[model samples]
Target chain A: MNSNITHDLAVPLNQEDKAKRAFVTALRVHVLQHMSGSMKNRYEDYVKPEAQKRGNTCDTPEHIHKALKSDFMFKAYSSARTCAQEMVFDVVSDSVDREFETLRAKAKPVAKKGSLTLDDSVEIPKSVSEIDVHLAPGSYHAEYTEEDFATGAVYDNAIEVFSFGQFGKDSNDIGMTLSNYVRLKFPDFKPAKILDAGCTIGHNTLPWAQTFPEAEVTAIDVAAPVLRYGHARAESMGVPVHFRQMDATAMKFEDNTFDVVFSSMFLHELPLKDIHAYLKEAYRVLKPGGLLWQMELPPMNQMPAYDNFYLNWDTYYNNEPFYGTFRRQDYRKLLTDAGFGAEEFMEATMPRYTFVGEEAYKEALSGENTFDTLTGRMDPKGTRWYGFGAWKK
Target chain B: MRRIPRKRRGERNRFFQAEGVDELLSALLRLSAEVSALKDRVYIAEKVLEQQGLNVSDAIEAYELSAEQEAELAANRQRMIETVLAQFDNSSDVDDMTDENSKIEAAA
Candidate 1:
């Protein structure tokens, strides 16, 4: 009776679930990540100009998903989406490995490069300063020269792509789907200033522009390559988000400047202490009543056996050392410690499809397992979300 | 099928469990940090070794932290364990992931 045992349960997973798990997650991951041409061609085909024009990167999520309806495009999205993260991981990991070798060979005698050499004090921080932060090298530090700065971002982005897959804009729009639910539930859920930090490739950040068309949206990360890629993506998609290379802990913004500070799947990659620092920083940067939010793995206490197993898979062998730790902590208390008032927190699991039943999600509000990654396999009634919500005091 | 062994439970949890934020984990983790540091130390120490077959402890003088430093580091580690447990006893954020759902591309 170990729940982590792998297999589909009695819950009849439909075609969408099957495609997500079987085809996209499994088959597409290999091609998009390990192979190059196939993924590039597939991405171009999936996001043709016509399809992008139809997709609303500027409308509300409800309108965006509703207005952007092409059966073929949606199907292609489904096909390419799961491979999204896998491809990022493949590309970035391979690039970093090759580049790291060059870095080592060059630095063996002295810690200097040509016109691109980094400053003297600028050193790669030990990976274990706080915890075993991995699946990434060069973990976001200030650069001295032009070349090392580029090298740092290149390594970081490569690991991200390897971990994330293709970094596709369509897949990144999943957050906007939550915006659909938020809009329906709280029609007044509007924030004037939105920040998506550590937003590599800008795919996740662009969804915010669509989610709140009125909000001024900006996305930041330490890697310039992904920022450049994200910028081109924003220009091509016409989403109009400002992308910059910046660290999460020390973002280049004035205090209390944002109504909403959000990040997606970003916390677990950081060391535990770094997570605490980022939370404190988020509290510092948010407006008096601004909300702090994220869409990420569910807590460990709320997870069922199989779901816990699913969450564990990445943490174990994937070089993502801190992911499991991030999922297991009490987010409500964490937010409270960071500054939010108690009992101000809320969690929800948005519906999977327009017609999906509600019985599974009825008890979503009081710390259910909906938003957590493994929620599907564990909670029989279906999870609403492992979400914890709160408003700034 | 097969179960993961206790020796490898940490490894199992690393891969399988949602990231648990156990404060007590730093208890065992210190050893890993030491070993990770040692890997680099040993690599460089061996390179700087003047003679053949010097032990890791003997080679330590050639590197950053000596054997005496490691032992003292171990003592400081003991004090940290008690302090960590006493202060943050049950106040662990290691078990939670859902606060408020934001917009993102998570499969869940």
Candidate 2:
């Protein structure tokens, strides 16, 4: 159950920290799985009926959110969940503090194969600097000293605890699942250059390099600390990745430079305008006939009202203000507006490569979409990843 | 050591309607986490001692405390209880009272 980080730059946790992480993980599971069920029951049995009496249909996620504002069970669930979120970061940050020097030393060795390019001029976007996205303290950009990667260490370690082992052993299941899907689905298209945009610590980025070893893997993030840690992490793992500190919205890469531009769970953190800008940048950087695939939560329109309300909890409570807004947008239209041919736009629901083995996943791919209320959710029952992309022409 | 900020910016949402309830819940969860950590550490110590060929459970069961040790333990327990209960004590506020009569009355 303690599927903690195994990489070289992994923060060393004492017995108490490990236990705290376990407690937080359990608390999250209880809140998300068990208490969430109770909240839904309360809504269906009590809140929904009460709303109906007043001629309110409770037809949308916003309506459901408004109705549940006064519900005690919902309040308790939210409180517990928020506490778990804070506790996870607190425990991990403590561990990072204890081993700050050790981590810095570990991250010091120059990459033999991989490389890091940090830019001091890149302005930290307000979306990240203004608030701690997902309530992660420091928001992956803060640095106390020159060449500090504590925020990266915090993120890499805290997310493993936060995910509750749902994101695979290395917390790279999103990348692993999506990259493998592209490999299997389109066997003929061999990408020579790959780019992972907004790859925080390259947890999801490294899997793409592993999936396609021949590809020249490059990952970019606006934050320099994460890029520094990610560079060392990739080198320690013996994967050659080019880590650069650059914003995805306005990438430094030339036009048609990459055969594939990928992002996993990155877009939702951006404001609507930034999402569009990032898409345009992605389209510009991708070569003709190349792919721009992203692994994201399913759109709100694809889900029932209740599930929309459930998934959008992060938007309101988790400090991800743009989460619901991104989900509400038409994903296909977003791609088409970015200059991707509408006919070339494609989307798929594939099983998580690590959860369901490769063979089972391949078999499932040709089968039904297999998307339900649990798709893209952190629930243990949610085994599938929803991916949308368009081939540049 | 340089440490990342544990508290995040932005207005924190209050889930409970009553004042201080949310803070109380947070404190309760922290207490629970501490309890769980203690349990984990105990289990880890037992396993580690077992690996070193020490039967911890047997030793613990057979152990007997002398009078001095017992008194020390009792004092320690009392100290812990007092320390925990001291957080709820408002005597410090009364001590800081500017009015002389109110201080004497509060002490009584």
Docking quality category of candidate 2 according to DockQ thresholds: acceptable
Quick one: best lDDT, which candidate?
2
**True-contact fraction for model 1?**
0.00
**Per-residue lDDT of B4 in model 2:** 87
Which 10-residue window in model 2 chain B sums to the lowest lDDT? B85-94
Give the least accurate 10-residue stretch of model 2 chain A, judged by summed lDDT.
A11-20
Output the number of the DockQ-best candidate.
Answer: 2
lDDT of each: 0.47, 0.84
The digit string of per-residue lDDT tens for model 1 on A58-140 reads: 22222323332332332223223322333333333343333443433332222211111112332222332222233233233
RMSD of each: 23.4, 11.3
Summarize candidate 1's per-residue lDDT along B40-88 as a digit string, tens digits: 8867776666456555554433345556865675454433332422322
Error of 2 at A46 (Å): 1.4
